[model samples]
Every structure is written in C-alpha cells, then in structure tokens.
Target: MRAAIPARIKLEITLSYLATGSSYRTLQRLFRVSRPAISKFVPEICDAIYETVKEYIKTYLMKPYSRVSLTKEQKVFNYRLYRARRIVENAFGILASRFRIFEKPMACLPETVDKIIKACCALHNWMRITSSNNYTPSGSLNEEDIDSGHIRQGSWRDEINKTLPSIGTVGSNHSSNLAREKKDRICRYFNGEGAVPWQE
Candidate 1:
C-alpha cells in the first residue's frame, strides 16, 4: 500500500491552489500529486479550513440610501458611508491582486466556492495581522491626501480592474424601520460628534 500524503503537504497544496487558481495538472507538476487526488482533496481541505476559521470572518450588511435629493446630515452620512465603502473595496482589491484566484470566477460548485472564499478571507486576515508590512507596503493601498482630502488610487486597483468588471450600483426603495432608525442615528453621529475636520 502507498503511504498517505502528509497533512502539511495537503494543506500547502490546497493553499497553493487557492492562492494561484492553478489547474490540478499544473499543481500536480509543481507538487508531485496526482491530478485526481488533488481534485478530490482540494475542496475537502477548503471546507475544513473555512469551517475552522469562518468565525473570524465578519460581514456587515448595510446600504446607503439611493436618492438624488438629500439633507445636509444625510449628505454627510452618505459621504462617510461612501468613504467606508471605498476602504472595503480597496481591501478586496488588495486581496484579489495578491490572490490571483479572485481575478476570475472559480469554476466549482457553489458550496465549494463559498468554502474557498471563506478560507481565502481567513488567510488574508492572518497575513494582514502577522505580516502587515510585507503584505501591504506603503502606497499599495488607497491613500487620502491630507490637504485636498482627495483619494489617491492604489496600484492594486489598476491590477484588479484589469481582470474584474466594475461593480454596479443597486438602488432599492425598501428599508425596514429599524434599519432606517439605525441609519438615522449613524447619520446624526457623523454630522455631530463623529464629524471629521476634512469632512466639512
């Protein structure tokens, strides 16, 4: 009987596949594993990693109101919200640029895809925390001009945009009362105590 592949090698293989989106054949050449074995184990490894680290991945679901006319407070709120959204986009842009896997859609089952994404997110967070200097060097991410308050696009944006399509804005007319209340509170805070000097 053949000896089993070690757990560490399996993990390395899975991570390599996720990071590069390389084909099994390519990975087989690189890792010396059979393509069929790689295909069978990659998804399982992703699922395991995702399950272990999914709790570290938190998502906030909030959308700014899509309207033309707005009050000053609402405008301030929107501006702040937009800035926050930009930060998030930049983060994903960095992730996509670093991990070529996200440059294109994964050709896999939806569940497997979800696992892959979760696993990648966990790994991204880990790298950011442990090796922030190497992971995100100066000027690699969007920067705000102190004097002009203008955003300087990051290099990651150029690389990511080459492969990914621009995201479209989705307008919605419906919002729950609780969500509205929360948005109002946040708006009030931004316009009031939380207001930044440059936001004026």
Candidate 2:
C-alpha cells in the first residue's frame, strides 16, 4: 500500500473541491494527489462534520404541521414560517455566491453532494460566528448595521408584478400536504402555549 496523506493536505484538497466544483482529476493535477485519495477524504471529512452537528440540524429543521388543522391565529403563525423560508433562501444565495462550487452542477453521487453541502453550511455558520468582522456581503449594506434597526428589503420585484398569485396553498403531492400539516401544527403551538408576551 502507498503511504498516507497528511490531514492538512486532505483538508486543503477537500475545501478547494467544495469551493471550486473542480473535478477529481483536475484536483489531482492541482494538488499532486490521486483522484481516489481526493474522493475518499473529501466525503470522509464532510461526513465527520455532519455527524458532529447532526443534533443542531435536527433542532433547526423541525417539521411543520398541516394547514387543514390550523385555527385562525395558528394560520397567522404559519404565515410567519413561510416568511422565514426567505431567510433560508437568502442564506443559501449568500453561501452560493461566496462558494462558487454550489453555483455549478455537482458531478458526484447524491449522498456525497449532501455531505459536501452540509459541511459547507457548518463551516459558513462557524465562520460567521467566530470571525464576524472579516466577512461582508458584496455591494450590500454594512454587515455591522444590518441588525441595528435597519429595514432590509428582501426583493425589488414588486414593481414588476403588483398582483399576487391566485392560488392559496394547493399542494401537488402527499409530502407537500404533510409539510403543510406540520406547519399548521407548529403555528398552533406558537400562537397558543408557545407564544411570548412581546409578540404582537
């Protein structure tokens, strides 16, 4: 058997692949490492990160309740959940823009792709927390003042289409129905026992 590659080299290769979406052969040429070694360590490191943070993932990704079971107040709470989805999408957009690898098609197995994404997300959150001063979104407002009573507009498409869609939460599949149901339940919980005094 060949000698083992060092952990530092493995880390650099894995991160470079995730940041650039470079093919294994390309990475092999660039890093002077074998394609097999690159493939092996990248997924291994990603899986380790995922396993380490699985609990946090579960906590943040709780399922939503269905809409059919929602009360009027519960429905309003559910609407807030829908609004929160924009935050997730905005985070994704920021991640993709920062790490161009996500912008390109990932030419790997689905499981491997998931691991890479999870690793990147974990790293991104860690970086944001540990080094908040170093990173700023390009052409956006100063990151420092974002949370300082500044109203940020999520989109500018209202001028293009003032009318809202006619449909009202019609799902095309059982999974969608289940997700809606979960949201409604969460909403009910929030508006009732889960609510805080400060919430309007």
Candidate 3:
C-alpha cells in the first residue's frame, strides 16, 4: 500500500516550486508527486492566496496618482510613496535572480500563471521575514568601497560646517557674507569638488 503525503509537505513543495518557478516535472521529481497533481495544486493554492490579499492591494494601490504640481507636503508624501513602492520592485528582482525558474516563461495557463506569481510573492515575503540575521553579503567591503564611504561622510560634514552661520553675528553684514560663502562652498563641493571622479 502507498503511504499518503502529509499536507504540510504538499504545501511546502507546491510553494517552493511556484516560488522558484520550477517546472511541474521538476517539482514531481523533488516531491515525488505526480506532475499532474503538482500542476493542479500550485494554481489552487495561489488563487487562495491571491483572494486573501486582494483587498489589501485594492485599498493601498487603487488610489489616484499624484501630479508634479502638488504642494510641498504632497510632493514629499508622493516621493516617499514612490520610494516605498521600489521595495516591491526590488523584491521581484531578487526573487527572479535567486530562483532560476522565474528567469524563463512559465508554461502554465494564464490563470494558473497569475496564481503561481502571487503565491511565489507571498512565499518570498514569508521567507525574508523568517530568515536569520546572519544573512549579510559574503565578504567584507574592499579598500575602494571603504575609501569611498569615508570620502562621502567627510564631504557631508565639511559642507554642513561651512554652511552654518557663526553664533555671535546673527544680523551683521559679515555674518551674511559668511553664510552666502558657506552656501557657495557647499554647492561647489557637491557640484564637483567633493564628488567621486567616477560619478561623472
């Protein structure tokens, strides 16, 4: 008699296969499931996940886009929102790179394809949150990187120090000239003096 595969094992295998964009045949070999079964369940589970998260997507992303002529506060809000949305783009890139399966066209039906994509994103988020703290890049920064970091930090400090007005001469002409000079110095530094040579 054949033993039944556990539900947890099935879920994990389906998710791993979808998340990595591995072929159903590939999943069959790894999980010892029939290719048909793997193909059917991956989409089913994906649909379930998509259903669960659909509300969140509509609430957060269905709003109107911001125009460039907005007020300062609105502009800041839009800028921050744009930056935050970049995390989603980065997540997709990371998933595609890490899972070679996603690098190719997924051969499943369109509905199945959509479900599989959603499921993989969910699995990716879960894995990222649960991963250990020791997952930094493989090696320490090289000398050039270290030097570049120091140079940027030093330039920032110098610019800030030069721009700040002296405490004793709040309204004097000398202080105003000093402040203007400080601003000019900072502008020059950023424009060329403090910039990395390769940045051009």
TM-scores for all predictions: 0.85, 0.67, 0.49
Candidate 3: 10-residue stretch with minimal lDDT: 135-144
Q: Which pairs clash in model 3?
A: none
Candidates 2 and 3 compared by lDDT, better number: 2
- Which ranges of candidate 2 are over 4 A from the true structure? 53-71, 136-172, 176-181, 193-200
Model 3 misses residue 166 by how many Å?
53
- Please provide, for model 2 over 1-200, each residue's C-alpha lDDT reduced to its tens digit, 9 standing for 90 to 100: 97789888888888788777688999999989998878878999888776765544424454334557866676567556655665665556556655656755677889899899888887766655666456333433212233464545433222122332344566753465566677567777778788866445
Ranking by TM-score: 1, 2, 3
Instruction: List where candidate 1 sits over 4 angstroms from the true fold.
Output: 51-56, 166-178
Query: Which candidate tops TM-score?
Result: 1
Model 1: per-residue Cα lDDT over 127-151, one tens digit each? 8777988988888889988778898
TM-score of 2: 0.67
Q: lDDT values of the candidates?
A: 0.83, 0.66, 0.54
After the best TM-score superposition of candidate 3, give how far the Cα of residue 132 lies from its true spot, in angstroms: 5.3
Per the 3 Å backbone cut-off, how many clashing residue pairs does candidate 2 have? Answer: 10
